[model samples]
Target: MLHTVNKSPFDSHSLQTCLGLAKAGSDILLIEDAVYAAMSGTAVTSMVESAMNSSTIYALEPDLKARGIGSEKMISGINLVGYDGFVELAVTNDKVQSWL
Candidate 1:
């Protein structure tokens, strides 16, 4: 568990209530503005690509380049960390939930 959505699935449902309570292998990151739901075609991008078939999404590469959102507009298996890979995924994820 390491869910850390920073809001803005088009202005927050807190990333659809943290992807409906996240459970399977959870590790979603998506920092500030929730990295716009890891991009790729908006409107929640197919619910963050179907929660990446049971969670492992990440995005924080400097908050997607300060919202310019590069990485080819993300979403192909999401995962783009940086701040030391978000402190190595909050120190290898024992728990880090922060949906707000």
Candidate 2:
């Protein structure tokens, strides 16, 4: 399963949902302003850890940089994937859910 968190409430809630499922290959994508959710030691950060520890997680690099978040400061387990990676996720995942 995979989820994209594009809004704040959904970002928080969807992450919580993913945590419970803890699927072997679950993924959470933080894009748009959701990229800012990667700052260390926040709700989003904890969520990032929870999802990544159990499955794959990624951030949209262009969105992060566009918002002034450099790639170096990204949270651990949160890889910076370009458009190609995003497309790959879409193609590879069994299911994709958008949290907006």
Candidate 3:
């Protein structure tokens, strides 16, 4: 399964809720303002990092760039993907759940 979150963790609980419900081995894609959660040293960093133990966490590269977040600011092991990569993930996963 693939879970996409587009809300900022600081502004919404959508990312946290998605993380809690996403099954092990699922793919979690952080898009839009949700990309903030993929950065290191944030309040949600530890949570996101812990989720990586059981799931693959990805952040949309374009979104990160738009938010002025460079790769160096991102947490290690969190994959950065482009629109094409996002499409590939959606196509590869059997299901996609969007957390607004």
Candidate 4:
């Protein structure tokens, strides 16, 4: 499954809920403000790291750049993807569950 989270962890529990319900081996695509959770020093860092153990995590590059978050600011192992990559992921996965 491809789980897309667009809410900021600092503002909502949607990311946490997605991480909790996402099965092992699922793909997590962080978009919009959710990219904040993938930053190195955020409060949700530990939770993101924990989720990494069971899921392949990704973040939208455009969204990160829009928020002034560079690739260097991202946590280790979280892949950065462009819009095409996002489309590829969507096509690759059987389903997409968006956490609004």
Candidate 5:
């Protein structure tokens, strides 16, 4: 999943969706402003952590830095991946979907 939402409302639902998929053994690829979830102490942060506790989760690097959430500041488990990483996940996953 390439979650692109930036707002808290969107993050809540998007984070939940990612966690649902992850609990089922799926991975998540967050894009655009969704990278904020990688930050520490945010609502989405805990959500990402829960998802990661079960499955793989990544955030787009460009998105993270664009919004000022650098890799150094990312919560413990959120992996920051590049564009090539996105391609890899798309090719490796059983399916792909975008969340607005």
Candidate 6:
């Protein structure tokens, strides 16, 4: 499955909730404000790191750049994807779930 989370972890638990229930080997795509979770050293960094153990995590590159989070600032294991990559992930997964 592919999980897409667009909310900021700072203001929403949707990211955490998604991570908690995500299937093993699924992919999690962070879009919009949720890209903040991809950065290292944040309050939710541990959660993000933990999720990486079970899931392949990614952040939308354009979204991260818009929020002033460069690829260099993201957590080491997180992958950065553009619009095309996002579409690719969506197609690769068996299903797509968007966390509000």
Q: Where in model 4 is the C-alpha error above 4 Å?
A: none
| Residue-level lDDT for 43 in candidate 2 | 51
Which has the better TM-score: candidate 2, or candidate 4? 4
Extract clashing residue pairs from model 1: none
lDDT of 5 by residue, 12-98 (tens): 576565456443556677777667667887655666676676677788888877888876788877777899988888877766766
lDDT of 1 by residue, 1-100 (tens): 8988888788768888888999988888888888888888878799889989998998988878988988787879788878898888889988788887
Q: All candidates' lDDT scores?
A: 0.86, 0.71, 0.95, 0.95, 0.67, 0.92
Model 2: lowest-lDDT 10 consecutive positions: 7-16
What is candidate 3's TM-score against the reference?
Answer: 0.98
| Candidate 5 deviant stretches above 4 angstroms | 1-12, 21-23
Residue 54 in candidate 3, Cα distance off native in Å: 0.3
lDDT (10s digit) by residue, model 3, range 1-100: 9999999999999998998999999999999999999899988899999999999999999999999999889899999899999999999999999998
Candidate 4 residue 45 C-alpha distance from true site, Å: 0.2
Clash pairs, candidate 5, are none
Candidate 3 error regions (>4 Å): none
Native-structure RMSD, model 5: 2.7
The predictions' CA RMSDs to the true structure, in order, are 10.9, 2.5, 0.6, 0.6, 2.7, 0.7
Judge candidate 6 at residue 95 and give its lDDT: 90
The clash count for each model shown is 0, 0, 0, 0, 0, 0
Q: Which ten residues in a row have the lowest lDDT in candidate 4?
A: 65-74
What tens digits encode model 6's per-residue C-alpha lDDT throughout 13-46?
A: 9998998899899999999999999998889999
lDDT of 4 by residue, 1-100 (tens): 9999999999999999998899999999999999999899888899999999999999999999999998788899999999999999999999999999
Point out where model 2 deviates above 4 Å: 9-14, 18-22
Residue 61 miss distance in model 3 (angstroms): 0.5
